[model samples]
Target: MSPRRHRGMLLLVLCWVLLAACTAQPTTEIAGSRPVDTSARAMLGDLRTLDPCTLADTAALQRFGAVSNAGIVSLDYCLLHLKPDDRTLIQLAVGELTGPDSDRPGDPVVPQGALNIVQNAPVPGHCTRRVRFGDGVSLQVSADLLAGEPGAGLCGIADAGAEAVAGAVQQGRAGHRDFPPNSLALVDPCAVLDTAAVNQVPGLEEARPRPSVGGHQCSWGEQSADAPRVQLQHTAGEPPRILHGAAVEEPVDGRRTVLSVVGGDPQVPLCSAETGHIPFGTVAGQVEVAQLVVAVPGETGTDACAYARGLARLAWPNLPPANP
Candidate 1:
């Protein structure tokens, strides 16, 4: 075999071996940054800056049937509209820091380029294929279907979408979003909040920062029903309002903010402090906001609202300010 062809075969075999290992022993690792395929990384550049919508190729998706790009529904994913049934849809999530937790052992695996794509166990009306490129990071392609009215296997559809993404990377078709200088979409939620900030909240001094799949949201402390936790999210939305309980208007980093508390269990109360409108990109109507929240489950003499507000004050200034 030619040297190039031999190398391709070796890489394909390696992908399958990794997939077998993953199915034999499921991973329990937390989601975070990890090294991935060198070639993919070189082609895609920084994942945090890449535009997820670039992977949702309309021409590629139309192979299944008539499909329309619905644009991006979130910072990390894009939605596509499929025809012939209202119950069928497709979602492509990129730069996701972790594969879906729902993935199970023995889930079907397929090799796509240098990645091992795992087809998650199907739910009642959904199927997902996760293309894990890094230790915990992956791209997810999902299909929503209604049973008994099916045209194609949901998993097969998901795989097709995954193939498109892999091909895009191979062909260097993936692109980056041109975020404004101050866009919240560029912020890493995990970096703004530190251990010392979390330590301010009683009983959460040792809490570790766990970033969401997209790295736009962060949570501290164990994810349990009774554990005290702190969460911070940077998103584009309308200004905050009084949704529950009484709200107090406050200023954090010279920005108008709303602080509110919601009743949960007597021992654990949920409190949140959300900022007023800050400028994001024009695609989201230029409105951006940050939320700092706390939920305490035990008698720690902690005022959830006060902790959330105080954290907000410390973290708000770190966010990129709008240009004059």
Candidate 2:
């Protein structure tokens, strides 16, 4: 085999092996930084400048990697990237509390008041760790290496770096940044649709973000015609949302399902989906979910509601989820 091809195969094998090792090997050897006493929720808000690319102390850590930040920081997460090279880099995302304590393994966590930190199972060319800010939020950090040349020491680097960042957050230390004006403006609305799901509805084949009577809604329809389209809109109001708390279904019928289809207007066939919060990403504060509406003149109610549920499945996962 050519030298280049041989190297590629070897790297793939190494990654598979490392990932398997990460599955359940909990370690106590992980180190901790100075104790930080703070709530995860409060830290998230103080992370006023949530740029990971430029951390508070990037100058001292030139030995390993330079800093980089990718996405906007919000109440849910602040994603970070530390680049040592193309083949090796590190990532960290501080997230809100996901669920009960059983979500992660019971590893030794160095308690810094409300802060909780633990090393997670490793992934290919990566070492993952968790730093729970008090009881309500978590800091997920990972070290990534594309090739074995970067070596196995990545886990340690990921762990120490995560601990330091977690502490920095607790102490209200973050890079200077200008926060966005609207809280729910961070995520791309068009990115949430299931390509396959939207295509199943005839005429309503294209999906794009557009404003409608109900505020900012995503529309899927023929570029040539306006009717015969399915759209998902966001409305924050009181209860009785069409598909509120309804399980996702196919070929949504007016008779049987989690919610009997809201058959109020013959002109607009629609359903409702409520945003209940276990964890809502960008749509956390949203109270009600308006079902996908099919407004094609000749379309059946079944097709309209089906398109709504299909679109709901795609959109629901992206919304800040209600409680699990």
Candidate 3:
């Protein structure tokens, strides 16, 4: 209660405050004191048909070193390799959609017109930055140093790549993918099955189509709910060899359909039907495949394969002819 004790306590508090301030992690602050406009993302156009490679601006990335296209990783991503010392690889994902429920807590945003660029936490030997569009869609720039390569200034390269992507989108240079008329690339996954066809499955009676970021995939109803849900994706790969359950092979209008139920639990399993329709040629042995899946929940004891076969039959007539 004396003046001496009061003075000492005040000094102690001041020291603690200073220490905390020095150790505090920096929070995200928007550059230029401005927020991005979400509407500008509309220029990117329909995600399914948009060519993600267009956003990888090689000119902007050239400052770091030589830039080379790594090719399409998926319908939603275009990969690029950056050579700074000729061994350090920078793989950039142009546009990968992260839904609203994602848990990534991104740091400081740099506003580029309508885009908000953010630097994500780096893992060992790797760094990533993202151009977030507020709607859970993002273009990520990643720099990974190969073994025995130095990691110094690795994140700086990611920042530069992210800025380049943002600039490309802002300048309206983003482009769309083109495919031949008879190619399966033109098929919309959402249109492969109608609402009525989806409703025929239990739990999706009132479900509607939710298109994936690339529009090459589609889903109906929530997977975790008590009802069964359906998902269809257009991809290139050989059909999976069914393991754990009956591997029923059937023909739908000459299309080879393979059906199987796979999961650890018998009450709830993933019923799938894979059909090959066209040639993709990415790999000598790979072909364009339509993967139709039905996830049954709880103890519904639904005839998953039967429904899968029915859906395949319904979808087969609509799919592009094989090898066209």
Q: Considering every candidate listed, which one attains the maximal lDDT?
A: 3
| Ten-residue region with minimum lDDT total, candidate 3 | 12-21
lDDT of each: 0.60, 0.43, 0.62
Clashes of each: 0, 17, 1
Instruction: Give the range where candidate 1 is weakest over 10 consecutive residues by summed lDDT.
Output: 12-21
lDDT of 1 at 232: 76
**Model 1, stretches more than 4 Å misplaced?**
1-40, 62-73, 80-95, 99-105, 134-136, 143-157, 211-215, 237-250, 259-268, 276-278, 298-304
lDDT of 2: 0.43
Question: How many angstroms is residue 314 displaced in model 3 relative to the true structure, after the best TM-score fit?
Answer: 1.1
**Model 3 / residue 286 / CA error / Å:** 3.2
Q: Where does model 3 exceed 4 Å of error?
A: 1-47, 53-73, 79-94, 97-108, 118-161, 167-176, 223-227, 237-248, 262-268, 299-303
Q: Residue 221's C-alpha lDDT in candidate 3?
A: 70
Task: Note each model's CA RMSD in angstroms.
Answer: 11.8, 17.0, 16.3
lDDT-superior candidate, 1 or 2: 1
Highest TM-score: give the candidate number. Answer: 1
Question: Against the true structure, what is each candidate's TM-score?
Answer: 0.68, 0.40, 0.59
lDDT of 2 by residue, 189-219 (tens): 4455555676666654564444321122445
